[model samples]
Target: MDYGIWNVIELLGALGFFIYGMKVMSEGIQKAAGDNLRSILGTMTSNRYTGVLTGFLITAIVQSSSATTVMTVSFVNAGLISLVESAGVMMGANIGTTITGWLVSLIGFKMKISAYALPLIAVAMPLMFSKKPNLKNWSEFMIGFALLFLGLEALKEAVPEIQKSPELLSFLTQFNDPGILTRLMFVGVGTILTIVVQSSSAAMAVTIVLCAQGLPIEIGTAMILGENIGTTITAELAALVGNVHAKRSAKIHSLFNIIGVTWMVIMLPYVLDLLHYIWPAPETGDPNKFTLALFHTTFNFMNVMLLIWFVPSIVKLATRLVKSKGDEDEEFSLTNINYDAPLTAEVSILSAQKESIKFAEITKLMFTNLKELLNEQKQDTRDKLKAKISKLEVRTDEIEERIADYLVRVSEQQLSIESSVKVRSILSIAHDLERIADIILRMSKDIERGNKQKSIFSEKQNKNIKEIFGLVDLSIEQMITNLNGVYGKVDISGAIETEMAINALKTKMRKQHLKSTEKKEYDVQSGIIYRDLFFAAEKIGDHVINVSEAVRGDFGKDDEDM
Candidate 1:
């Protein structure tokens, strides 16, 4: 049979639709689920076992390992999880991805299931039309699920024509030419195609279709193997713009997949024999779809069982391989970089918490330095403190850019319904953090001016300022440390304490301002200095309140501190 240009075009079109539908569906699911991803992930303990379990559970729900890994990176970037915890999450993601293979196997054989997809689209389209976000998410999920089925049908239709074409069949045969070298070539093609498409499931789907259409099992598995390695590129790409720690996490993903696939390649015959034992060729039956599903599951499960025990060695090897260069501070390393293809819900929450910690630390330090500047009772010391505050302002800008980039990637991770809400929470927290940093910078600048003019506040005013600073400093430290832990159902007491101190300071400062304004005992210069101090103090108080509001999930307007 001479398959013409139109047939190939049809095949391509079907593949396109199938991929598009899957993309749509994954996004919708993520929209539905991503908010909880962050909080769920945030709750993972330092224990690697639990960390891996968290990763596994999230990926299972999202049906995408890339989504899980990406979320892990985001959490890490926000400093929500330690590197070890992130790695465990990545491991769990690998296990979770196996579920898709099972679902595919179960569904692929059903000729009638295609009918369900259309109704799914119909239901989803209406929801998509709704103004509500939840409705839109539901609509998207249906539409996406429908498209996937339709695309599969198209893929099957597109296959038969190509199967009949001698030219196309012959070309494919070159890779299936009963030689190991040819098999490896096919593996390379599969890896490259998946990498290009950025979707292992799509690649897997295509492989299943080919196998269903009577392609050799050996050839299909080779492509699947390639896909495993191909998927790692996403994590690596995520780390490219991220800090060193992120790069490290991505590297581990790549190494883990590559090494596992390599071992599979070396023991190819044994692997095939194992598959054959598990799924013997049906003597009377046509190439059974169940057999295909079995292979996919058994292979992945075996890999997990084999490698899960080797987690320590894998970690050591990956860490040593991606060592940081000298002169590099680990603190600035991309510890929190995420690898999710799109940010999932669980990750968003984790990312938000991480960002809050960083923001809190910066704000606390900013104030502490300001207090020192006020106390400098040494011109040089005051100058150094001033310079540090200016540096901090620049740092806040960097934090925004970095965290925002990570969040955008999180947006891509195909989040879960619950995880999606947490993502929003995280986003809200990040904004509060940036705002807090800005206010702190303003205070820094004010303190700098006072130091330059060799000005001092009245004895009473100085004592009050010192008292306020002491309270804020103590609260911020507790807030940062507690933010990283799980006592939650609620935020750190720091959130409430921050509000209380700020309110007290605002009231006291207002009375002082009234007295100063009425008496006019100070000169014009003194009045100007006094006014700057009052405004700066008020701004700091306002920022702390803004932070508390964010933790409380009150995204209302910033609370003015008197």
Candidate 2:
């Protein structure tokens, strides 16, 4: 055994190089595709079959099934797609992953693509400095594509030939028997290899290169099966931080792969025979790489064909396997955004938008509770309502901070003009919504203070305050609707009209309060409380209208008026 410690390091380094190139390439394509990629995933996954196609297309374009699966998990986590839809996408991702094996065979082995790596880099370097974001993104893709082939060539050279590593060959030769146990063992090897590298594609490449260096195709095929099982771990790990739905979605991927691998392992010998008969391996240079690639593709395609009919069943099983956290499940958490692995800027903006909508709902509840606090007569009940209002205000502040932080991270990335606008809209909306919560909390405190001082609103004062509360409620409802509705399609006029109504009511109440002050209808201290409550409601209306305006992407339009 001439291979030593440095040889192992060299091999690992080559693997690292290959994985790095793949990562850069995947990110470049994702960035370049931008909103168009999001639009595809959003629109095309209407049904199971279309979802499959969508998954395949995205994985192929990005050159990483792990990326596609994680993206799917994030979507499911965010509630953007249902579990059934995620199942379909995961199925398609399995098939899409085989593209890497084919690339390793057809282009990587047969062609000298690495020879042009330098020239590609040369051309990409100048474009990297372009003022146009699109141009810069495409240039990044070019550089990554070049790096990928160069790394692949490095991998091919770094692998030790079996003839040169007789000890390793002798050990591997024991697994050459066409027995089920040997097949299973190699499958385990493949799975471990994939996991160790954290990339099924890289694992597949290693299997191909090893086979090319004289390892039997049967062993190589078994390893490929293991790789299939191993790739699902990435999605599973990604889902760990996600919700129960996310966990279920990742389970679907694992179950699909595990079931496919189980049947394939049983039928491995026969399947290999069939492949050999259909596409005979060439005599020289371990030609079974093509056969292995074909088997990878055919196995996934057949698995999908057989299981697409049982997607509902798969979803049911996944649901059973991963239970929800019950009360915690419905708590206000970041369902849409996964800060652990930030998606593309466009996709992230969509996540932030959903979170903002939830924030709007929280704001609505805070105001609703504030109204309850004012009219709540029982001291115990009022204290509880006040406590709840305070808690909600704190929650709104935390939500604003998190969403803003996530958006700021998204902004740091290269962004399109439209995505940039979206980020700003969500930020402004989140800020205003937080402000509304603050105002509600302050109003609740004022109401509590007046109660402690033996000052209460008269019947007429209560009635007028209720009228203004009704109007503020209307404005909050509209704010929520706008947050959930389409951005450009927001009916700003209705929101503006609501703001005007709130303003008009506030003015009317002011006049009435002054008249009462002159007539001594209520004590000065009570009048001051009434003035504070109505003015706070008016301030809430201002913020509520600001949210709707942000939804319309109309920032700074009525700032002076507000």
**Which one wins on lDDT?**
2
User: lDDT (CA) for every model shown?
Assistant: 0.67, 0.83
Off by over 4 Å in 2: 44-49, 78-80, 163-177, 277-286, 324-326, 330-332, 335-339, 342-350, 364-392, 405-427, 443-534, 545-562
Shift of residue 304 alpha carbon in model 2, Å: 2.8
- Candidate 1's C-alpha runs over 4 A off are 122-136, 160-183, 284-289, 323-357, 371-386, 401-432, 445-462, 474-500, 509-535, 551-553, 556-562
RMSD of candidate 1 to the truth, in angstroms, is 5.2
Q: Candidate 1: minimum summed lDDT over ten consecutive residues — where?
A: 553-562
Model 2 lDDT at residue 70: 83
lDDT of 1: 0.67
| Tens-digit lDDT string for candidate 1 (286-324) | 453565566656666667677767777777787787776
| Reference-based TM-score of each model | 0.80, 0.81
Clashing pairs for model 2 are none
